[model samples]
Target: MDSLPNLLWLRSFEAASRLGSFTAAGVELGLTQAAVSGHISALETRLGHALFHRTTRKVDLTESGRAYLPAVRKALQDLAKSTENLFGGKISGAVTLRAPISVATLVIAPALAAFLESQPELNIRLLSAIWADTALETNIDFEIRLGAGQWPGCQAEKLGDDFVVPVCSPFLAKGLKTPADLLKLPRAHILGFDDHWPRFFETLALPVHSPTPSVTVDTSIAALEWVSSGGGAALLLERAARPLAASGRIAIPFKEKIPLGQGHYLIHRQNAPPSRPAVRVTENWLRELFGS
Candidate 1:
């Protein structure tokens, strides 16, 4: 038979290592300090290794204990989660999500109804912004941001490149022949994407110009709304434009897709894991939707 330490002893050892004090661990485990110490002592004897260094101020993990902690912690967490999955009631909680306004409007907002229908107990607080600060917001549980794949004090998961294409209404597109013809119509510009049109024209070997009667919007969704309404032509991010184009409400005037330096990223605070189990579920849903 394979030998295994008692589960009770493992619990005492893990708690002591995490709290750094046998008395505190005992209090947390609802046992006397002596019982906690005895459990760990018994565990160490079984394993033939000291799990912690005896100290006057506080107990410290021994080299052996340090090596064993990660496995023990993970095992305990897995067991608890499995128990909950099989027997626990539905997870009910609010999850705060922040993303670019364009993504929230066109992509996530449209699909969220079905997601919520499946988990009626789940409450999602979806927030949108035209631009995100360099730092991740402490209040947000998840953030889908648009930027370069690097942010200070953040773990940025690059989703996709910022691919954009010029789109206009079908009526407006009928008058176009080449890239330069885009200049003849009103050029709708989205704020915070100043480099898009300039780089696009420069790439196609045409001089970039801002024409009169042009409109500017703060969000890509706004630009798409303007373009779909035949307000003029606008260069839109692929993710934002996909739904409208597929519905046949808009037309892609050029085959050229300008690949920008920045793109969509899933943001997390550096060194901080999610605070709730619901966060993991919500993240998986978003990642699946984004096809990342």
Candidate 2:
């Protein structure tokens, strides 16, 4: 009850920390950048520590800010959920969702504007994640993960499956007439996802040999960029590759794609169902959008 007066200031701090920009947080919170800065400054004055490292270009979280953010975010969610549950389930606050960078770019980013427009009262913060198995933050409301739909303590629902095909720039793809053509040319292996190159060649009944790649990358997005820049042929997920192919950035040399053993899923803690009707509705909307 003592901290109730500072609720708005806490929210401003959380938004700025999460977004990494005071201006961006201001836009989201419908406040002027100067006003947002004042709120943060006032909060910092009360807390007796700087929460952000101010820079000429952008703001970044200080060590103390990073430690405080999750607690603030969880408190906000709990308060919003409890209030909504008491008030007949009207969804009004934000939902924090995390997904892979590739998926965020390919699927959600494009559709998000219209979705937000339709649900004016609901806010969604979509964070780009690098790893599927990264530590699940206590404050995250939904996670879009790629796996067998079995998160330790979460309820997982399959969103969709994806497959990878050998792709290259239009100029490079022009020379490749057959699968064997890929073997002769330079190939860039996306370390984790393209470990199946040997198996794919085996499925084609070609003699299995260790492929010496022209280069190797850590993520599918980088591999796509490398291939699209005429770096070399590489295996990329069809969902990601198809758009690149359509946009003339890359081409699939063959229609055949190797099915990945895993799929994307929407997961949340099993013990903690979303108490807001709006959140539950959004969950249903995600299932429908992904065809679950």
Name the best candidate (by TM-score): 1
Note the residue pairs that clash in candidate 2.
Answer: none
For each candidate in turn, the TM-score is 0.69, 0.63
State the displacement of the C-alpha of residue 282, model 2, in Å, after optimal TM-score superposition.
3.7
Q: What digit string (tens of lDDT, one per residue) describes model 1 on residues 47-137? A: 9999999898799988999999888878777877677678876767999989988889888898899998977888999999887888888
lDDT of 2 by residue, 25-91 (tens): 8997899899889999999998888999999878998999889887888888888767756875445
- TM-score, cand. 1: 0.69
